[model samples]
Target: MVAPASAPRDLDRYQAGLAQLRSHYEVRTAWTSGQERGYLAAPDSARTAALHEAIRDADIRAIICVRGGYGCLRLLPHLDWTLARTHPTLLVGYSDVTALHLAFYARAEWTGLSGPVVTEWGDIDAETTEPFRALAEGETPTLGSNALSPLCSGTATGPLLGGNLSVLTRLVGTPYAPDWEGALLVLEDVAEAPYRIDRMFAHLQHAGVLDAVSGVILGTFRPGEPPTDRPTLSLDTVISDYFEDRPYPVATGLPYGHLLPRCSLPIGVPAALNVEEDTSHLQVLQSIVAE
Candidate 1:
């Protein structure tokens, strides 16, 4: 485990998850200033060193993030692309970790997992752990969801990309942002108001990102604050206002994001989305792991 973003707020939960992980594989922690409590897991120098250490270590096949609150963007410029390319370790985490996944894809043409973090292990159910296990074991499982609400109808295929909407929006115009052209943009977030969500969508639309993707998979957008008496647009309304007419297909309720039993999505892997009537199907086209 590495604290590349924020420090784990709940040590008990962190330890419990750590124990569970250790039971499956030999786990090692790349702890630095993150050993102390604060908003950031550590200073940029310490966090960067820890990440580099993990990347360069031959024994560490994968580096799992402790949590995601903030601080990943700060480590972007300092990341050594050469070390990452040469060592090629898998990175695992989501939310703010999206920055790392995009950076690896953009800079090193590497793939990572937008899956559970260490702190979430204490309460993760078997269903949630299954996808992560499948991916880690080199199995390419097709995640088809007849339960998903298909917003647009069509079939599209591209490199599966993107993560938290808020985090991805912040990456716009940065050197780390991935090329959205011919990519399947997966997005989800938590706690943001509908208006703020709309604002981020508007930002992406204005940036030409919305038009460049092959399709969109919308995950859980859990409400942050309670509803206010002030007039507001519903999330569905806000989403439709932006993507209702897009040529590419758009599907909602991907069964990922902040909700439990989140499926592990492979960043930069080829995937296909088929939407017809009210159903949406997602199929991972190939193995993310090398044979």
Candidate 2:
């Protein structure tokens, strides 16, 4: 899928991972161009067209994005929502690929995977990929964080939604933006400074999207040290400023997101979040795969 910028540097690695995947499922690949590596601005029309054709193919059971750098937004206007709605399998990826997840959920309520891309296959430890593999085999995936710190402890449940904060916010006013209402929102981002995170949260709040969320599951915020000048606000303060007063639970410590050892989440599926006893857990309440 490589919807965003491609990772030609990992072509051999991607092929090896795909070959491994093929041993497990009826794997398929789409024709792409050198431009898809994002050497140029956006992917060629042939690459985008190939993606459209792949989705409409009834035989395709899932689409795994190759990598995420930057390019999905440009391709959004070019996708065919009609053919996309007919897509019966899971859409998988994270980071910039969140654009496609929100679009798929918004346009047709199709399930999406907020997990590893093909380039990351080498890092797929069993602890991380096992639940995803189980889900791929038509079993409902189970997720639990080893630790969850409570901001507002309580219990809530709703369809799971959200992805990389920067990417999700990019779609806010667009037609592809998801109506995050009645959702147990899960959010994670990488490298963005605390103030930038605060601004994005303010944007979501102003857009009236947070009003729809029943609870929030926070994942890794900064995969590395945030580049900030002195007197920088704490990310915790920013999160609490937005979430502490909410009636629903707001918790952190999800294993999914930019860090290693992650699990794939079924976007838009019902989820249960409990923050009672100062401990927390989130569970998908229904099956994502069709029987």
Candidate 1 per-residue lDDT, tens place, 60-103, comes to 88899999999899899999999888877788999999999998
In model 2, the clashing pairs are none
Name the runs in model 2 displaced over 4 angstroms.
Answer: 1-4, 37-44, 223-229
**lDDT per residue (tens digit) for residues 108-173 in model 2:** 778787878877776577877787877666665446645777888888888898999999999999
Number of backbone-clashing residue pairs for each candidate, in the order shown: 1, 0
Lowest summed lDDT across 10 adjacent residues in model 1 is found at 30-39
What lDDT would each prediction earn against the true structure?
0.87, 0.77
